[model samples]
Target: MVALMCAEAVILGTNSKDYQIYSLGDRIFCCAPSTGIERGIMLEISNQVECQYRERGIKPTMDQVRDMLARKYENVSSENVLLVGQDRHGPHIYAMKGIGIPQTLIYAAKGKGRDDIIGYLMHNWKKSLNLAQAEQLVRTCLLVGENDYVNMCVIYKEKETWAKAVPQLEPVAIMAYDTESAFDDMTSMGSNLSN
Candidate 1:
């Protein structure tokens, strides 16, 4: 799993099976080792979270979500979970280990190929990245080979809030280029993820 905050959006990506990413209100939730039980737990939590925000207009804090997960951790099969969202305080990334307290992060990756993904992000991520650049970065980092597919979610606020999840059935073709060239291409194509 990979979760990062870009200039105007939070991006989450994973190559895991069984639909590991979900939307909770305005937030994007991602978990690793997705199983039937974990999916069920996530569904329950998402409903509760959406209700809290919809009925009371109160967004649940990362800590609150973590506490909720802790209460149900014993039955879940997930080992790592990431939550990304924005609030009055701005964008936030929360990384949780099992039922542990959520750790605030600017970017996070877990499960298989985590080290490689983290290293790539550490060397490549920039604060100025737009939605296209961030999405491409995630796609590049997640490309293990010629046959891997990626599931991605982009969470951004326009007038209200929006979350888009795209599941790629075909393998993403990897390209080699410097950051400057990639940025130029993205700009020329006007490749906004929201579009």
Candidate 2:
């Protein structure tokens, strides 16, 4: 009997305090986020890819590298990896899981709060969000979430990607008030939360 393995892909980004965003050229952007054992796996994969690119002086297509890693990880039952990159043509997002064989994750895959987050993003996300806007979406997800599993996040494109440590947000001093009044209250309390 073949035992099937399942895993969830974690898409996280850092808090606003310290964020690392990179730009390679004019089009390519990249960000990688992994945790648990997959952290080491991701590092190894990234190092190998960088080494190869250095030697060849040419970057391989994201699909090619992804398929190669999937093959390498086919033996693992549960693995989570999220790699976001874009080329001149457009963006390429890869959310992968190592089941019986490593398979790419689609938008429909459900794992805990994954569905809710995906739904939130689907409604808020657009093709036209600039780099800052994109980063905001990621930050908002991590900042507003109740989940502890996500401690990091990566937001990347073909030219630049940002990775940062996402610190948990403290409970807000919520109060009943008008919208404008609430905004001012929150703004004042926001600085205290960071302290």
Candidate 3:
């Protein structure tokens, strides 16, 4: 799983079913290496967070979520949770591992291929990236060529959260007699790669 703060929005991307992401009120939560027990824990916590938001009109802070996770650490000691949300302090990203203190960050990635994804983001991410660019960067980081679908969650500041499964186009295989010309042709105006 990967999550990044881009422009006025936070984007999360994942290609695995074991690490599912969920939207709770204005926040997004995801657990790594999810199992029945971990998923139940996440759902229960999400419900609590949502209820608080609905009844009090206040979003849960990262620290508060960390405390909640800390209490449930025994049940999900091997799993890590990543959260992204907006509050009075503005948008934030947090990473929590077991009973350790949560770390605030501009971006976070975990689970399989996390190192590679984090490396790519560190080199390619920029503060000026728009929503589309950020989503593309995440999709690229996931190496979506190998996966058929990429699940995404976007939390926009002061706006409703959006979540979807983006389908990836099938990789094309081509044999060109003239390699340079073929590359040029693919980069031409009408080609999908032109953009």
Candidate 4:
């Protein structure tokens, strides 16, 4: 029941066209489409990777993403996943999956069969918006059965403004950090990059 139910997930991976990979702490920020359950699996991956990164002080690669996911998921393949978007301003979201070798980049993976395939067609043809922009345009969404049957709601870059798209679930139990503190850290990192 849980495994088969429909859902949607978005991951914005910052792999600048040249296959250059960026990593932060124990997490990698990449966007992929998934169901509610799969999203949970990804969260598990993030948590595990965080611990590993802390102890070993290493960045997670596609293979590491694989290892972290292999235990809880089956039929694990890149075709079933995608790393979307570009994190132009450093690692915005440190989210990672898998734990073996490196997985190439793609935005979201569609499930097998007609509905999924056609849904992708519509997403590409009709919507005409890149994953990032589309993801940022939603309020309330539900991923139902097939093709556009899914929907999404999110709090994009800003707090007051919310966007809704077809097929992303609003995350529960959110966490907030001090923006000023984070800004200071990023400012220092930027200086280091300049040097």
Top candidate by TM-score: 3
* Candidate 3 residue lDDT tens string, 1-195: 788988878887787776777655455555454666667777787899889988999777756775776676654454356777775556778777656456788988877777888888899999888999998988887663366567888877654323435668899997658988877886784676555
- lDDT by residue (36-121, candidate 4, tens digit) is 55566666667777887788886566454544555555545433343322222221222233432233422233333425533443
TM-score of 1: 0.69
Model 3 misplaced stretches (Cα beyond 4 Å): 31-34, 53-58, 159-195
Candidate numbers, best TM-score first, in rank order: 3, 1, 2, 4
lDDT of 1: 0.74
lDDT of the candidates, in the order given: 0.74, 0.45, 0.73, 0.38
Residue-by-residue lDDT tens digits, candidate 2, 1-195: 001111211233432222222222222222322244544555566676677778987675657566655665676654334444444433445555555243443222223345555666778766566555655565565544454332333334332323435667999997776989888899989988988
**Candidate 2: residue 7 Cα off by (Å):** 30
User: Over all chains combined, what TM-score does candidate 4 have?
Assistant: 0.32
Clashing pairs in 3: none
Best prediction by lDDT: 1
Model 2 regions more than 4 Å off: 1-36, 98-112, 147-195
All-Cα superposition RMSD per candidate: 19.7, 20.2, 19.7, 19.0
lDDT of 4 at 107: 28
Q: What are the TM-scores, per candidate, against the unseen true structure?
A: 0.69, 0.51, 0.70, 0.32
